[model samples]
Each structure stands twice: as C-alpha cells, then as structure tokens.
Target: IMLVSVTERTREIGIRLAIGALEREVLLQFLIEAMVLSSFGGLVGIALATAASLALAHAMQLPYLFNLQINLVAFFFSAALGVIFGYFPARRAARLNPIEALRHE
Candidate 1:
C-alpha cells in the first residue's frame, strides 16, 4: 500500500520534470519534504523508544548504554537514505518525454 503511494507520487513528480523541471529540483523538493516528515516522525519514535528502554531496563535490572546521542553517522545515514531513495525517482523524471508525460492522465 505504502509503496504504491510513493510510486504514484514519484510518477507525478516525473510529469513535472517532463515539463522542463530540473532533476535535482524535483529530487530536492521531495527529499526535503520526506526528510522533514521523517525527522519529525523519527524524533517521536526515538523519544518513545528511549522512554520504553529506560522503563524496560529498570524493570529487568539490565546494563544500559546511557550516553546515547545523535552523531555524524546518523546524519550520514539520513542523507544517504534521502539521496538513495530519491535517485531512482529523479532519474525516471529526468527521462520523461514531455509530450508523453503530458498525455498520461
């Protein structure tokens, strides 16, 4: 269900590109939006996970890695994910034929 949604959205982006939009522009637009949304969602998940982990640790009396912090690795992972995920859609958009794409609906 989710994959279908993403693909359909990507196709719309491709149509935009077919009309002379730059590949990077389309990619960046989607990537930025996705990152913004994902960041908010990830933060919420992180907070919940942190609280749950703390409670679990206390209950189970287990050792914990208490110094958890975001780092360069996390940044890189996020960027890489954005680029990697965005690349194919951007490429498809770039390859569109304006006439054919305009005919798609």
Candidate 2:
C-alpha cells in the first residue's frame, strides 16, 4: 500500500521537492498518511469485533466485557506496524531525485 502510494505520487513528490520541500517533510507526510490509514482500519476492526462480541454474549446470556487495554494495544500495534512498513517507501520517496521523479512517465 505504501509502495503504491509512493509510486502513484511520484510526480507530486517531485513537485514538492522542486518547490523546496525538505526530505524529512516528504518522509513525514507519507508516514502520517500510512499511520492514519492503519489507525482507521484498526478502529473499524475493533468496532466490528466489539459489536460481534456483544451480540454473541447477549445471545449466550453472558457478560460482555470491553477490554480497553487490549484495544489500546491493538491500535498501537497497528500504528507501529504502519510506521515500520511505511518507513521504507517514505524513505524512498524522500530520496527521489526531483528531476528523475518529475520525468517519470
């Protein structure tokens, strides 16, 4: 996903670099995009899991417990995974030569 993003936005990155955007800034932009995407997915997953668990517990006449710690851990883990996975592509985007990227067809 990150690679696709970087590849798709090569021209944008080149324009940004051409316009004097710093490498770290470009890197940060991609990193933030990845984290947001992962975090949103994680939140949706947690919501679905919670709803399903609640439905099952009610059907079984059992207590439904929402484990905050587990949810937090999962969310953070997903965000961390995004950062780890995104770093490579972000680094690559940041390192792109403005002329070469702009000339990409």
Candidate 3:
C-alpha cells in the first residue's frame, strides 16, 4: 500500500528526469530526500522507544540499567534502509523515456 503511493511520487520524478536532469542527479536528489525523512522519523522512533522502554522498566520494577543510545549501528541501519528504499524509485525515475513521459497526461 505504501509502495503504491511511493510509485505515484515516482511519477513526479519521472517528469523531472524527462526534463533533462541526469540519472545520477535524480538518484542523489531522492537519496537526500530519503535521508532527511528517515532522520526525522528515526528521531521520533528513538524518542518513542526510549519512553516505552522507561515505562516498561518502571512497570516491571527494573532499575535504570538499560541505555537507549543512538549508536553507530543505528545510524548505519537507517542509512542502509534509506539507500535501499530510495534506489529503485530513483532508478525507475531516471530511466523514464523523455518522449513518453512528456506525453503523459
């Protein structure tokens, strides 16, 4: 379901590519957007996770021994996800035939 909407967004990308933007440029643009969105969502997720962890610890009567630190591993995972998800859309958009795309209604 989510991917369907993503494909719709890709249409706009196709338009951009058809207008003379290079493939690598389109990929970079999508990568940057994905990184920005992922960072914002990751922050929200980390905050919620921290709150939930604290609440669960309190409820179960555990001490503050566990830590919720944003380590290198988390950064790597988020970056990987962003790149992985953004690549296909960027590639699809970059490959659009300019003539067909321009003709699209």
Candidate 4:
C-alpha cells in the first residue's frame, strides 16, 4: 500500500522536492503515514480482541479483566513494525530524482 501510494504520489513528491523540501522531511512524512495506519489497525484489533474475550468470559461466567500493559505493548509493537516496514519505501521516495519524478505519469 505504501509502495502504491509512493508511486501514485510521485508528482507530489517531486513538487515537494522541487520546492526544496528536504529528503528527511519526505521520509518523515511517509513514516508518519505508516505509523498512523498501523496505529489505527492496532487499535481496531485490540478492540475486537477485547470484545471477543469479554464475550468468552461472559459465556464461561468468568470475570473479564483489562490487560492494559499487554495492549499497550501490542500497540507499540505494531507501530514499531510499521516504521520498520515503511523505511524502505520512504527511503525510496526520499531518494527519488526530482526532475524524473516530476515527469512521472
């Protein structure tokens, strides 16, 4: 998805680069986008798991407990993975030749 986005936004990236946006700034922009996407997915996953566990507990007549620490860790882990996975594409975008990118269609 990130790759596709980078491909689709080549012209925009070119414009930024042409306008003197730093490569690091482009990298940061994509990385932040990745982080936000992963974070949202993580939150949805956490919510679904919590709901399922609660349902199971109710069915078994057990007390449902909230595990904040584990959930936080899971969320952070996902965010970390996002940044790791996004780095390559972000770097690719950052390293794009502005003139060539601007000619992309």
Candidate 5:
C-alpha cells in the first residue's frame, strides 16, 4: 500500500523536492502517514477485541480481565511494524530523482 501510495504521489514528491524539501522531511512525512494509519487500525482492533472478550466472558459467566499492559504492548508492536514496513517505500520516495519523478506520467 505504501509502495502504491508513493508511486501515486511521485509527482507531488518530486514537486516537494524541487521546492527544496529535504529527503528526511519526505521520509518523515510518509513514515508518519504509515504510523498514523497503522495506529488507527491497531486502536480499532484493540477496542473490538476488548469488547468481544468482555462480552464472551459475560456470556460464559467468567471474569473479564482488561490488560492494559498487553494492549499497550500490542499497540507498540503495531506502530513498530508500521515503521519497519514503511521505511522501504519512504526511502524510495526520499531517494527519488526529482527531475525524473516530475517527468512521470
């Protein structure tokens, strides 16, 4: 997805670079974008899981335990995964040749 996004935004990125945006700036932009997307997904998943667990436990007459530590860890892992996976495409965008990218149709 990141790769496709970067591809689709080639012209925009090229314009940014042409207008003096630094590589690190472009990298950070995409990295943050990815992290935000993944973090939102993780939060939704956490909410659903918590709701389902509580509902199931109640249905079965079992104690429902909410583990903040576990959820926080999962969120951290999710964000980390985003950074790891996002780096490649972000790097590709950062390293793009502005002239060539701008020429892209």
Candidate 6:
C-alpha cells in the first residue's frame, strides 16, 4: 500500500526533493500518513467489534466487558505496525533521485 502511494505520488515527491526538502522530512511525512491511516482503520475496527460484542452479550444475557487498557494497547500496536511497515517505502521515497522521480510520469 505504502509503495503504491509512493509510486502514485512520484511527481510530488520529486518536486519536494527538488525544492530542497530534506530526505528525513520526506520520510517522516510518509510515516505520519501511514500512522494516520492505520489509526483510523484501527478505530473503525474497534468500534465495529465493540458493537458486535455488545449485541452478542445482550443476546446471551452476559455483561459487555469494555477494557480501555486493552483497546489502547491494540491501537498503539497497530500504529506501531504501520510505522514499521511504512518505513521501507518511506525510505525508498526519501532515497529517490530527484531527477529520476521528476521524470516519472
């Protein structure tokens, strides 16, 4: 996904690098984008799970258990995974030759 994003934005990345944007800055930008995407997905997943869990619990006459700590941990884990997985593509983008990227259609 990250790679595809990088590929899609090749011209933008090229322009940024050409305009003297630091490689680290470009890398961080991609990483932050990935984190945001993952966090949003995680939040949605949590909400859906909670709703289903609640419905099932109610049907079974059981108490719905909501654990904040567990949710927080899962959220953080997902964000971390995003960063870890995104690093490679971010690095690739950062290392791109400005001239080559700019030539990309």
State in Å the error of residue 75, model 2.
0.8
Name the better of 1 and 6 by lDDT.
Answer: 6
How do the residues 20-85 of candidate 6 rate in per-residue lDDT, one tens digit apiece? 999999999999999999988889988998999999999999999999999998899889989999
User: Model 5 — which ten-residue stretch has the worst lDDT?
Assistant: 74-83
lDDT of 5 at 40: 85
Name the TM-score of candidate 3: 0.72
Whole-structure CA lDDT of model 1: 0.60
Which candidate would rank higher by lDDT, 1 or 2? 2
For candidate 5, lDDT tens digit of each residue in 1-105?
Answer: 899999999999999999999999999999999998888889999999999999999999999999999999989888888899999999999999999999997
TM-score, candidate 5, is 0.97
C-alpha lDDT values of all predictions: 0.60, 0.96, 0.67, 0.96, 0.96, 0.95
Model 4 regions lying over 4 Å from their true place = none
Pairs of residues clashing in candidate 3:
none
- Which of the numbered candidates is closest to the native, going by highest TM-score? 6
What TM-score would each prediction reach against the true structure? 0.60, 0.97, 0.72, 0.97, 0.97, 0.98
Error of 2 at 33 (Å): 0.6
Residue 7 error, candidate 6, Å: 0.6
Model 4 per-residue lDDT tens digits across residues 11-105: 99999999999999999999999999998989999999999999999999999999899999999998998899889999999999999999999
Score residue 25 of candidate 6 by CA lDDT: 100
Badly placed stretches (over 4 Å) of model 5 are none
Q: For residues 8-103, could you state the per-residue lDDT of candidate 3 as single tens digits? A: 666576577767789888777776777766666676776677788889889999974544355445656776787778777666666767666666
lDDT of 6: 0.95
Any runs in candidate 1 off by more than 4 Å, and if so which?
1-6, 10-15, 18-20, 61-65, 70-72
By how many angstroms RMSD does model 3 differ from the true structure?
2.9
Pitting candidate 1 against candidate 4, the one with the higher TM-score is: 4
How far out, in Å, is residue 102 in model 4?
0.9
